[model samples]
Target: MRLHEHQAKKVFKDFGISTPEGKVVNDPDDAEKIAEEINSPVVVKAQIQVGSRGKAGGIKFAEDPKDARKKAKEILGKKISGIKVKKVLVEEALNIEKEYYVGFTLDRGSGKPVAIISSRGGVDIEEVAEKTPESIAKEELDPIWPLHDFKARKLAFKGNIRKEAIQEVSRIAQTLYKIFTDKDATLAEINPLVLTEQNQLLAADAVLNIDNNALFKQPELAELREETEEDPLIRKAHEYGFDYVRLDGNVGVVGNGAGLVMTTLDLIDYFGGKPANFLDVGGGAGSATVENALDLVFQDPNVDVVLFNIFGGITKCDEVARGINEAIEGRELPVPLLVRLAGTNYKEGLKVLNDEKLRVVSDLEDAVKEVVKLAGE
Candidate 1:
């Protein structure tokens, strides 16, 4: 789950990380109030989950309380990267002498947490990685041991952080790692961890994404989901009790398992079609679950077609077909749907699909081809 900037900064501040004083406001008047309270040149930042809010005109500077209100009015209710900005974080603006990046994420290849430190910040880390690969310093830490200050300091030195800022950078990295482990976070980031004119290191931006699977153990962090999770599609998927991820594509996919769903997505891509969403109905799904899965896919305006692939084991294939039939029965489908069923009760499932006169493919590749052609992708 992605925490909003304000929430992430709250967590950071609670951990003794210095952050500019800020307050979240939904109304423009409240924004002005925050500015007045701060009594300084402030920045009005849209409280959306996505990054690059600056590029989307979601981050604006305000000279005073009135300017903060004006900026808030311009930002509130506007969509940034497709998320509606319901709130803005009014924060005291910083005179940054330097910007640095501190991040911790799992390096799947090594099966360990990796710390990424860099002097170049306030921009996409991917850009820095791709263009100036040498500038970014990475350390894959052992999960069993805490990151020592000396090790973190060496990392800062490797990232070319100036001697004056090295101590602060390393300290922040250690504290950030603690936050990463304490909250079961998959990502903990501080971009533009800035040095102010007063020579203080402050986290100018914060990003903390808790692992969805780890939410069960972290009750407090899980509670932030309702407040921080802004993606409507993801929220809807959770409501339906399905494992889903939205994608930028036209082909919606529903499958019985993770491996099956992934294979189905790969097939759609192989056929030059985009897969709109990754939805796993999981093992032993019933007709209602399958029905709801299709309903969820059809809700996406970007979806031009849906491909339902079921490789049933404990899940009955016939039940799956029945759900598909019921989903398309009364309402006119906004997009084409293709089903490919195999495994347990396969013949009965095929019979059910045939009775409904629905399009069914016996082969996965054929289904992918037909769906792609139908979607015109």
Candidate 2:
């Protein structure tokens, strides 16, 4: 889950990391009060989940309490990256001597937690990597022993952080790694970890995104989740016990397992078809589960066509076929269905799905190709 900057800073503080004093406010008047409390030049930042707030005018510096109020008024009702800003963070502004970046995130390819450090900060890391790859230093950490001072120091040294600040930055790196692991976070980043004019290192901006699947262990962080920010279809999918993720494409995919769903999505991509969503019904899904998955996919307005890839094992292909039949007969679905049934009862599924509306394909590759072509990929 994405935490607003104010919430992320609180988590940083909880981990003994230094951060600029800040408070989250829903009202412009409260922003003024918070700035007055700080009694200094403050940064009035809109509390939205997406980044590039500064570029979008979601972040503004306040000269004083009155300016803070005015800035908050301008930001609170504004939209950043298509998300309406409901709150703002009033934070003490800092005089920066230098800026650095530190983060701990999963490297899915390596199946490891990667520690990243850079001398450059307050900018998109992707932009840095794209334009100047040498500016970033990354170390893939062992999951059992994620990060140590030596490792962080090595990263700091490689990233060319200042000599005097290397030790402190390394310490912060270790702490950030600890938070990454302890919180089951998918990403823990401190961008623009500023070295103030006073020679104090503080995390000027904090970003912590915990894994939603691990939220069971992080009750406090779970409370920080904004349900309203979630897509209604995704929330419904979760409620219905389906592992789902909405994507930006036209073809909708549903499979029995995560690996299967992922493979289907990859094939769609390879075939030049954009996948609209990833919906995994899990193993042992019955007829009702199949229908539910279809219903969920059908709810997506972006889906031009729906593809089902089911390799029946514990879940019998016949039950899945029955579910498809029931769902199709019950309603005239807006999008056409492309069904691929393999493994046990494959023949029975093929026989059952004689409906003119269902385009049943026995081969996974053939099904993907057909669906992509039909979706105008």
lDDT of each: 0.90, 0.89
The digit string of per-residue lDDT tens for model 2 on 133-211 reads 7889998899898587788888999988989999999999999999999999999999999999999999999999999
Per-model RMSD to reference: 3.9, 4.4
Q: How much is the lDDT of residue 134 in candidate 2?
A: 84
In model 1, state the lDDT of residue 249: 76
Q: Which candidate is the best by TM-score?
A: 1
State, as a TM-score between 0 and 1, how close model 1 is to the true structure. 0.79
Instruction: Give TM per candidate.
Output: 0.79, 0.74
Deviation from native of the Cα of residue 338 in model 1, angstroms? 3.5
lDDT of 1 by residue, 296-331 (tens): 888888798888899979999999988888888888
Clashes per model (N, Cα, C within 3 A): 0, 0
